[model samples]
Target: MKKSLAMLLAGAMVVASLTACGSGKKETTAETTSDTTAESAESKTVSDGETYKIGVLQLTEHAALDAANEGFVAALDDSGISYEIDQQNAQNDQSACQTIAEKLVNDGDDLILAIATPAAQAVAGVTTEIPIVGTAITDFADSGLVESNDAPGENVTGSSDLTPIKAQISLLQKVLPEAKKVGVLYCSAESNSEIQLQMTKEACTAAGLDVEEFSVASSNEIQSVVESAVGKVDCLYTFTDNTIAAGMNTVTMVANENNLPVICGEQGMVEAGGLCTYSIDYYELGYIAGEMAVKILKGEAEPATMPIEYYPEEKCEFVGNEETAKLLGIDISGLE
Candidate 1:
């Protein structure tokens, strides 16, 4: 009986040892898995915490372009991504744009935001490796900045500030029913202006109104151009051309003095003393560009495949300058 009891005790000891060994093995594996999971999470956190360097090249300082820059920065601020920005303005100088573009590229920026067509072109000319986002541009495809609006097929994409030219012409007809001759004025050097001019010509022809075009190479000739158009055309039509937009005061002063109501391309021009416009919100356009930049930075999207974005037509506003209307002795009450 004693021998049997001892044997039973030994058997119980062996079972306990086996049970302890199994429990230890399971505990070790669980601990190892927990440690590995923690390390992986930490690595991911470090990668996400990296700060991005962004460069912004703006064409010139104006109400529309300034608003675009503000909106772009606002988007980046809202994105929760840590970033450093190098903001540079070309002051409407193409050469300055080229210099700034080169500087930004040399600085090794991760991404670039080009405000206008010239700025975008400058940056694109500098680097094909760096991603570029353009805003306040009329048509990316027309400007040769992209292969197509639907598929950029390159490392360039953003929002287009292409306002409704047809609607604008209709507005012009509504405002000035008796006016027969319309003078189209824009900067000849601006590709965006050229596109708008073509659309304006088509729209004017369809409306059965005689249209005349006046092109300026630079802002230096704005005064002379406006004076030349005074007696020939009943109303002057200006586009969102950066050159003309910058010198809008001179253009409007001349037109207002001659009692020729100017139909502007944007609210900034209207506010600067033009008559009216169907204007797109440039700030919203920039915000859209900013969102695209965020997607590119996060690897969520690529500029090569991203289609150019546009503000919805419903978002456009029919804006008129009341003071200018009063000066021109024209009634814009119907616009309200």
Candidate 2:
């Protein structure tokens, strides 16, 4: 009886040993599974953190817009974010801008940067879900991109190249103090031009300078319209209208022939043929847009809450084309 009991006890000990071994194997398997899950989660996080893609739509090859593009790219590079850029120029055509924006949106670009007023309008028409940033836009209100200038109030918000009309008027007074009548020249189709022209007229009224708006529907009309204006107003004011900018040589020729000093809306125009300008750096404005884009992509800010920003300060330059200056015979030494 004692021997039988000892054997049974040994048998129970063997069973217990087997059970302990099985539990150890199960624990090893659970640990392996946990490690696998941890590895999978890490890999997923890495894949999710890949590079970003940005699409840029510029209205034309104008110097100001080109500078904005440069600034944007530079800022992106500075952020150390891997990004792919697709840039297209609309050649100052609204329909072309619309088509390019639609293509970019359809291609699943992560963000869109529209460089001018028309370009911004085109992107706004394409998609509201995708973030649209605008730079070099003259007036957001004039383009109907937003409800108010103080707040963009939409998916679209960015920098404005809208030089203060009062400042422009002040510059005009500095250059042509004795002039009573001023002619504002721009393209009729450009909302930016129209808005700037209206502002000019209002500022002129306040400054006691009679202002007449001269609109050209295309480059073909600029020469004739500017000539007519040259005969009418004592001085000329040119806006950053792409059409007018494209035909700057013609306008300059007409103004120079009539001895009328032309004050420009931006520095590029002044650099091309006008007298002087108080304008913001288009490149700086574009960099500001790039900064906003980084914030959006990182989920740090919402476009609706971020009001469009302006250049911290306007940059003024006395870009007097010596030839144009000589022809107009306007001594701007005081402005210099």
Candidate 3:
């Protein structure tokens, strides 16, 4: 009887100890599971948050550039992406552009948006590692921004406001059908403008019109260059070169004195004082660039792989200044 009682006590003690141990193990497992669930939720919240810093370098403070800058910011705001835009205008100074580019690079920007050819070139010189999205670039390859427009295959990519060069020539020819000699005006330092001058020269030559090239180093040279060419060529034409466009009143004054008609590369150019133009929408160009930037910042697209985009002919419009038309005494009745 004593042994039986002792065995019963031992068995009961073993069962009680096992139950306590099992309960302890169950409690530990529940606590571990609860911790893992909480940790997972915390990690998910951390992963869901994102922030970006964007740097913008604009070449000048002209109407076209200002519009582009506005469009870019508006698009970024509309994307619902958390970001900060650090913007600086170069004021049409090459050295200023370089300084701005260096500052943006040093700030460790997530990306850079260049608003013109000079700004893009400046940013491209700063870093190959930082992606650059450029708008209002006339020629990607000509500007030395990329190896190819398709599959840029490099660190630079964006939209081009390359207005229809040939169409511009056509518009000029329509307005001055009998004009034999056409004078081209632009800034010599602007590679974009140089490209336009060359293309325009070629187009005019092909059209059997004599081409007179007049180049200026800056706005200060505009008066002399225009004065010399205004009376010489039957008509005057210029691209949306920031330098020349900025001093347009001086140019129109000279051209007007000679009763010369002016054809321009953009609406802003015409708004200043030109007969007409086949041009791209500067705001839309910048807006498209902004959208591309969002993709790049989100890691959805790489600048190297992103194809350089261009506006279609439909996006191109014929804009003219009627006030200037009346002043020049040019019959634009057919164009309206």
Colliding pairs, model 3: none
TM-score of 3: 0.83
CA lDDT of every candidate: 0.86, 0.77, 0.82
lDDT of 3: 0.82
C-alpha root-mean-square deviation, candidate 1:
11.9
Between candidates 1 and 3, which one is better according to lDDT? 1
For candidate 1, the lDDT comes to 0.86
lDDT of 1 by residue, 99-175 (tens): 88888899788899999999999999989999999999999999989999999998899999988888888889999
The full ranking of all candidates by lDDT, starting with the best, is 1, 3, 2
Find the candidate with the highest lDDT and give its number.
1
Residue 240 CA error for candidate 3 (Å)? 2.3
**Candidate with better lDDT, 2 vs 3:** 3
Better of 1 and 2 by lDDT: 1
Best by TM-score: 1
Clashes of 2: 0
lDDT of 2 by residue, 205-305 (tens): 99998878788888888788977875688888886777777677788878777788888877788877887777778888899999999888778887777
